[model samples]
Target chain A: MKEPLLPALKMTLLTLVLFSGVYTLAVWGIAQLAPNGGEGEIITHNGKTYYENVGQQFTEDRYFWSRPSAVDYNAAGSGGSNKAASNPDYVATVQARIDSFLVHNPGVSKAEIPVDIVTASGSGLDPHISPKAAQLQVQRIARVRNLPLEKVQALVAEHTEKPLLGFLGPERVHVLKLNIALDNLK
Target chain B: MNTEILGVIAIYILIVLLALPLGKYIAKVFAGERTWLDPVFNPLERLFFKLSGIDPTLEMNWKHHLAALLGINLLWFLLAMFVLMNQGWLPWNPDGNPSMSPHLAFNTAVSFLVNCNLQHYSGETGMSYLGQVFCLMFLQFVTAGTGMAAAAAVFNAMRERSATHFGNFYNYFLKSCTRILLPVAFVAAIVLAFSGTPMTFEGKDSMITMQGDTVQVSRGPVAAFVAIKQAGTNGGGFYGVNSAHPLENPDYLTNAVENILILIIPIAMVFALGFYLNRRKLAWMIFGVMTLGFLLLSLPSIYSEMQPSPIANQLGIDGSAGNMEGKETRLGAAASAFWGISTTATSNGSVNSMHDSHTPLSGAMQLIDMMINSLYGGVGVGFLNFYIFIILAVFISGLMVGRTPEFLGKKVEAREMKIALIIALLHPFIILVGTALSAFIFYHNPEIGWLNNPGNHGFSEMLYEYTSAAANNGSGFEGLGDNTPWWNISTGFVLLLGRYLPIIGPVAIAGILANKKYIPESAGTLKTDTGTFGLMVFAVIFLVAALAFFPALALGPLAEYFNH
Candidate 1:
């Protein structure tokens, strides 16, 4: 046992150098070649900078609402609420979200609220929402913005992203992008 | 079939192809034979031994091996706790993440030390760069090395007869880290980084959204961390979303790479056993049985996940594209299902899709995989788990045939049987009991609320957490609020017991058998390496897991499935 200790410590140090230093540096070098030089993808709009990949909170009546964020859309820390379905508090939170949505959109019925609209996304930074989720909020946005309903509907269609290869994942809209497009409307 | 499904199949095939050669290389390394890397590593290994005052010739009995393993692990646990708790003052805090709370630090320390890597805290916010590199990644290597070393001790014990001393634990541990884990992790990290995973120390960067809103985007040494996380079967992730994050898994190619890396070492270890024992046919048989079980569970999960969600159908949406909720678009349904089963099967809990959002039957399959975790489990320890089942099968079949039970030429006495039974039984004992206790608490105090989806699905979430902990598979349903004190402390104890006992039990049994007088194979002896024995072991695994977990399954995912 005593005989192997030195070797154990030595190996630990050697591997630490290899794994913690060399390997990390090699990866960093490789990441340098990736898009944005491994930095977060930045999008500029109206003299403000934003991460194109991350979701932004847009709770206004005239804007498309992003998915509820457990971390309040703080991209610095991303996570789900991790509340099990049976937890009464979580159930109430979802219920509250539903009630709030209903109050905001009187024309939409309680059953019309999609699951994504009420439940927080796994990553608080999920940028996209199901097209259905975006469509559900259409009435409220059109009413609040005083935009033609057809015009808002056309914008939703224009911004919708199809599944990869046209058959993978659900059709979805990037809420930040959709809201930006909505703001840009003449 | 779609290209996506075809791509997944191709990757699985590639892993098996790669594992065959990798297994041979691993066998050569452990056996101390001349290998291509010997020139480079041999001198380094000798220097390690010389500097550490290790003779390299000393061997230890089972007790000493266990002591060394446990002692080193305890040391690491303390060190990790210190680093995690004091990270606020420690270096590399560009993001200024605070030290983990004591209970969470305790839980995280134990989780990584046990090779469970079940994270109650999100990596980006909870840990600093120093914590990620020094504390978490460091444990990933050592804990995985400890398990492999223990398995190597068992392998040595089984190979030698009338031997009181198994090979030195330190030697095995060092070799596993240097020869197997480090080399693979080095290459994998580079691959992941090139595929867009960040490997920088820079803190969170503020970016503006297209909507002109500012978002603080977190970045870290994710690529390096992710490689070892999957390779070591330590499933903690750099981001809260785990492999679901684009940086951690940017595209289908990277997704396929991560998935294969998760299963490669565990799968290869099976073949390594065959090479070490000079019993190629036996290894193939065992591999076949494990693969069969894996396919049986995985195919159903894939099929179920590709079917539309019942809720989606009720909403009158076009359900033709299947359940894409909580899954990345690049991975889609088939690849996600494959990853779900592979990760759970190998006890590598990194995920490209959230298990919580899986359809009821797919979720049940994930639970079943972890319950019977021996389907090519984590690295070397996977074979050790299967060995427990093999012993039970030997005893039961021997009783049926009216003969004395023996394995590998050693008499399987009551003492050996007792240890094997304890190891096998302890898994379900902790899982079911813990689930029951949590369920009871949830029932009485709904106000203590941790669940997110109500009814049967809610019950399944609790069951999945305990099962993941007990199996040392760290994947969760993600709907459970597990950071609370009740979860942190409870699962910490479960993780420690689940990891050490399973390892110690199998190694001890192997050691005791190695010291017994040799009994050569005879007509009366059970042919353990045969196809029939493999089938018996398979049956024993199913029977034990089914008997222990069936009722729980009935209440959780099963009920949810049928209800839909």
Candidate 2:
């Protein structure tokens, strides 16, 4: 055991220097080449800076609602509610979301509510919502904003992001981007 | 294949190339050979042994080794619990994160202690920075070291001509940390930090979005945490989204580095075993079998995830893009699917994408990888798990040939067989029983509401959770509300039982075999190093997993796959 000890410690120290110092510097150097220098992609609109990667909170009926956030859309700390489906609190939370959606949009039915809308994403910072989630909220946004239904529908279609390579993920709408487009509507 | 798919393939190839040299270096480190680092580490190692009162010359039998492993683990569990339950007031908590609930604390402590890292609670809000570093990060080093130490002990026993004692547990443990895990983790941590993972202790930073709304951003010592998280195969992420967070995995290069980090040590350990025993052929045979299983599991995942979602087609949406519902655009579908398979196969549960959001068949593939569990598994323990199948194959084949069953010149008798069977049977038993109980509770009590999606997809989530816990793989479906007392407690027990028992059983069997009378090779002797034997071991693994888990899988992922 003593025979192996010295070599082991030497290796540890050397690797620490290499990994903690050199490797990190190398990786950081590469990251500088990445978008936003790895700080996160940022978008400036209307004199405000927004992290394009992080989810934004939108609750007004005039704007398309983002998915439910466990941390209330806190970009600083990301996470899900982690409430098991069996927990009464989670059940009530989902029910409350459903009820509120129905009340806000009289034309929408309880059965038609998409699961993604009522439940929080794993990352509280999920910037995108499923296409169904965005579509379901369109009627409410059109009514509240006094926009024509077909015009708003077309906007929803325009905002929808297709899965990568046409077959990777489900269709989704970047809520922040879509809402920004909405505010810009003539 | 497209460039994305080809890139993923190239990455797998690179892991093999990197692991080969690492394996040789590890073999030398364990054998006490003179190396370039000997001058630096020798004095430090001597100091550790001297201060701790561990005799470098001492050796211990299997029972003593097992005792040392469990005792240290229990101590870690207690320490982790104390830190977690008191984290709110503890130092380094700039976020003022509250202390964990009792059940969650218990689950978390046991999860890390066993290297299971089955995180029921999110990292950012659920734990303070002190708790993250002291409890979780500390366990990452030791637990990984513990598994490697145990495997090294088994190697010692197998290599000896005739000896009841293998080596000192403390010595092996220390060596594993200093010589292997610490070095790799150091480099990995730096890489992660450089790639934009936060390495600070600052509290939440407030930022105004383009919408003119103020939002709080959570940051902590994520870079350091993620390094060991991947390298140690601990899999618990600093953030709730694990590797999916931009800070946790900032870009494509970070993704590639992390995926390679997750697999390098586990694959290297196999080569280390070969080098230690001077059985390079046997090592290659084992590596071949594992790589085959890995490829079999990974390809379908990529294909399934690459296909357009059938539901999207029904909605009149283009199905040209692959499944990306739960994936980051930086990683794309191919990389995400590759990670889905790699993470589960290695018992490294860090995810760049949500497994729950994958296409039904892709979800099933992830579950299958965990259920099989030994395809290049977590560090040292993976080979140990596969060793059980190897023994079973040898024994069955020996019986068929009307000869005595022997491996490495040691006869496989009733006691050895019993332990092997117990270890092999225990995995499926825990997974199936836990899933059955959860499903029963979900069905009998309508108010429980454990299933989020309802019907087939919901059942798949429950199955995935239990399978992850039972295999000590720790990745979750995320949609399942699992932070409650029931899940925390149930999975906690499964994590402990799953991690220790398999380790103890295999090491004990190795000790027993080492003590048996050695038999010289003859014409009738079954050569385990051959490709034929590797196939046999592979078949036995699939057969056993199929027998025990097929029905349950059919009910969950399989059922969901067909329904979709």
Candidate 3:
């Protein structure tokens, strides 16, 4: 009985070691194979910035708009601005974002700037943009990439997530991944 | 409004009538009867226990049991968090999704473990097949069983007199999962599979489209987990979009069946309580109040939609489809319309339609249901809601008669009332405070605008997000940018306190009540089973919700609805 128990215990220990070993190796392989997209610096006009890997790059060509981040680098408090629409600070920020956006995308009208591009997201770190927001950027992106207007529009159209089963929420586009795909496009 | 009311009434009657008999069948299954219809799955249950070396007959006091339950859950939560954080490094990387960051991992784990299935990440794209199965699918079983276990403890509290023992927690937990939740889940999964929800290990579909373009459609072992997820009122969807995915919901019959399963057990707990207390009428009375509250709340929305939208009316589509904006065409008017109400009614926020696209009145109704904290709630937790109201009813009646309050023979004094009020009020407090905090303190900055929805409506979205989180109902009216630490940690924290605090308070109430002897039923005992009492409880719920959040809601969703 003692001999049998000893064998069973050894077998169990061996299986545990082997299972963990396999798991770690598989994870390493997947990580190696993960997306190798472009990286960039998060450069604000104020000349304050930091280096980022692929995840934080906000390229204009990519129709995908990531979730908003409310990280105030100065205050160092990571939070949603949570400012109600009536707040002066909130209104000022939106105006500034819209103003900057208009300056960058020359020849685009004020109405052409999607509110999503100007307004603060609740989390301040959203990675997806509404379909409306993505569509608004279509023309500007087409011109920047020298892609046909229809082709860039088509890309935005394809990436949109229609309401769950066509009935759940508004259509959405993942901005980060979409931008990455845009950069990769010929 | 009237049309919506009629539609809501019709839907509630249908859901309730359907859920009634199903609840009886569930009660029988839980009593350990081997049904001819249900296949024997106890072999799997026993196998799990054997592997874990947990004794089925182990006796434990309530505290020990609660600790064990909490301890096991803590381990599972950490494991899930770790797995989600390391997903890029994990197996079955069909989409090559990255691991969620610390905040998101914490949010997802807590959401499932607490039975609040609010997702910060999209399901189809964010998670791998292995992550979907191991972390999410399994938690459906555990979290749901946790609910039943909590209910069982409460039931023991009500049943016993001057006894500290609240049954065997391990036994109750096993009975809930093995005897009740699993069998129902197994059958539901089979039905879902039969209805076309896919059950497979295949990667996202790589087939060529009719347009001659190669497009990948995400696919997984969805049918198996979905059956229990809804039926147990666990509410987590296999895909990020939840029941909206064709493979997860498939068709009308599956949709209707899943909706009914999500509601039946919770509604039936009224009967379960009746049987346990040996008073079927009492069960019906509680059921009546809940049904009435649900119907009344849903009425405004249903009717609002039936009237033509100026835009839709000109398009020559039926306005009766009632806000078809974000709803599935297959589900259409009746199903999507009903699901919006039912999902909220049971605290299962997996929608078949876009709630944001709902008509103003209808949208407000959905928000109101969250404000009510889903008392006509999920499977076992519904009983907790009923239990809470029962205490309230007793307290009120006791006051009217100028006697000390008594519930099911146990005295309901100041201590009990205070505890009950705190338990009852705590969820609303969280909703109001969290929503206010999210709206007033954290305005969306670039670091947080994932969904990129703008303006006052955007603020409403964030407010609604936290409300759902704090109330532990995982539905959202406005799309949330949840990837940031603010939303993730805040919402994760909301889920935790919202779930555990109310639960712990109720359990403590049960223990306190157990120590008191049950007095014999006498003439002075309020006849709580009457429809009059039902109306009173409904009034109380409405009054409290209305009073607590009227100002905030008016400023947020209501303002947006009017402006939009």
Highest TM-score against the true fold, candidate: 1
What is the lDDT of every predicted structure here? 0.82, 0.79, 0.62
Q: Tell me the tens digit of each residue's lDDT in model 2 across B274-387.
A: 999999999999999999999998999999877764433433334445554556545667888999999999888989877887777788789888888899999888888998
DockQ of 3: 0.03
| TM-scores of the models, in the order given | 0.87, 0.83, 0.72
* lDDT of candidate 3 over B314-334, digit per residue (tens): 333223334433444334444
Candidate 3: deviation at residue B193, Å? 2.0
The positional error of residue B179 in candidate 2, measured at the CA in angstroms, is 1.7
The first chain of model 3 has a TM-score of: 0.60
Deviation in Å, model 2, residue B293 alpha carbon:
0.9
Q: Which ten residues in a row have the lowest lDDT in candidate 1 chain B?
A: B311-320
Candidate 3: docking tier: incorrect
Q: What's the lDDT for residue B403 in model 2?
A: 84
DockQ for each of the predicted structures, in order?
0.26, 0.13, 0.03
Best by the lDDT measure: 1
Error of 2 at A167 (Å): 18
